[model samples]
Target: MSLLNDPCATPAELADRCEEAGLDLAAAPTSSDLEAVGAFMAQWRRVVACSEHEPRAATLNALMLEYASAPWLTDHAGTGWHLHFREPDVDVPRQIAALISVGTALHLSGLGMDRLGICAAGECSKAYADISRNGRQRYCSTTCANREAVRRHRATRASATV
Candidate 1:
């Protein structure tokens, strides 16, 4: 969701994001690749922002249909085999889209559809995928939580004085 949250407008920035995400890219991403990935992020943000599980599932299913290829097992390196849900020899952007779509599907199903959310802080628009054991996470981070808490406290104090 970082791509959707704070988008990389340039190819270099997109490369940095892929690096931060630890993606093994066969080649440097291009502007066209960045555009494709940005579009994919937009669709994913829709899935995350949906409050209902049924709609979220339908959106995810559509994304998987559009982006994901048939699943295949591979051990590209000498490591143990693992399943890849995308076609081989695609560009980095397509690969990342497949990964995100599949990962989101797994996350929502394994956890709960409500586990995906946008931060509740009024000023923050960041999206988060909740993996907490209790699955009661609301804020994207502790900073947002603290900020909201302080806002509530100050509001309570101001009301009491009135």
Candidate 2:
């Protein structure tokens, strides 16, 4: 389980997290992978904006009322104490948005807003959560890192040749 904590999380799980964060980027996905990539960016933006702006409960309340429905409370199994933020019966979209709004607030306030970020690849635009020892992750994957290295090396060689 990624627990929404791991930075280098897998693509499949990333898709779920993206949806949970109110991202629906399947405008016309050529493939599932593209959809995943789009959703990841959307979720990343949401996390970044929330962290940077530090939205208040009232702001989230407005979003919930507009995009979602009135927030509700439901606890199942009662493992100690926790809140669901929305009724489980609510439609998936609203439920997801509500949770994303409130859950993101919790994550930013509890953790740190400087936790999320995009890949450092020259051309790639993937997102990450920076769970490193020094919290300095840059690239989305090893493939992107290699691609960037190749690009830089090729550019250097071309410049030398020129």
Candidate 3:
């Protein structure tokens, strides 16, 4: 499921990761800064994986600065039961981190810690939220499935030709 599904939960880093994965973003990421984004995504991968392995606030804090104060609640009206995590004016990164971290916490505690995962393709490293009825989604998309299938097919044919 798109992390944006949880309007309040989509943290900046998560949004960045989603953007990197070509999911969604308010603006297109600059190609020049891709390396910096890659660094953050690596940490984000750790954060998502930590829920199963070793979820620690210290580790999370090391990845990014902590929220300066407890996030306040704001209701934008008619948006249903969700909370805004930032002050009306704040840096986007901090705002995003708070939203994403809170969203992730809510997601893990409310649903289950095991609901997040990386795609299972051999060379793919995309993240995904298992929001299916059975929560069995593994690959990021059907394209990955097709690619892997083609790879295997080619390998089989190459061996046969040899």
Candidate 4:
């Protein structure tokens, strides 16, 4: 849920996020690689910005068009066979893009287009892809939800005292 907003994101931070996503990391990402990913994530923000289904789909479709190839199968490095939407020989940034673009498409299609949303808590502005069963997520996490709740309760008490 971190935003690189800058193409000059530090190598370690980029590596950590990639690692958390299960990407194989024999070495740290280079400057250009970080820049490429930063740019891609910028595009990703556009998808998150769209609150409605169609606009989100259109933005994601544009990303898939740019980054993904026709579906293909792979079992590279002894992993179990799985489908991929990217050419086998693409560079790291392109590969990452393909993985994310297709993954996002499936998630939105299977879950709900309204699943991707920003935190409703004041000034938090964090993005979250809601995977909860109920799908009523409004805040990014319990902390934000609690914070907003406290604010509401205090406001109610203050009004009662007036």
Q: Write the per-residue lDDT of candidate 2 for residues 72-96, one digit (tens) a residue.
A: 5543544434555665554434444
Q: Write the per-residue lDDT of candidate 1 for residues 1-162, one digit (tens) a residue.
A: 788788998989988888889666657999899898888898889998999889889999999998899899988864678988888878988888898999899898888888899999999999998989999889999999999999999999999999
lDDT of 4 by residue, 48-101 (tens): 768988889999999999999999887885768888798777876887788878
TM, every model: 0.93, 0.49, 0.55, 0.89
Per-candidate RMSD, Å:
1.4, 8.7, 7.6, 2.3
Alpha-carbon runs more than 4 Å astray in model 1: none
**Best model number under TM-score:** 1
Better of 2 and 3 by lDDT: 3
Error of 1 at 21 (Å): 2.2
* Tens digit per residue, CA lDDT, model 3, 1-162: 343222222344454665565332334334423344444445556766554435644555554445434555654454454556545555444444555656666675566666777777899777776677776767777898789889989999999999
Better structure of 1 and 2 per lDDT: 1
Clashes of each: 0, 1, 2, 0
Model 3 — TM-score against the truth? 0.55
Worst 10 residues of 2 by lDDT: 1-10
1 or 3: which has the higher lDDT? 1
Model 4 backbone overlap count: 0
lDDT of each structure?
0.89, 0.53, 0.57, 0.81
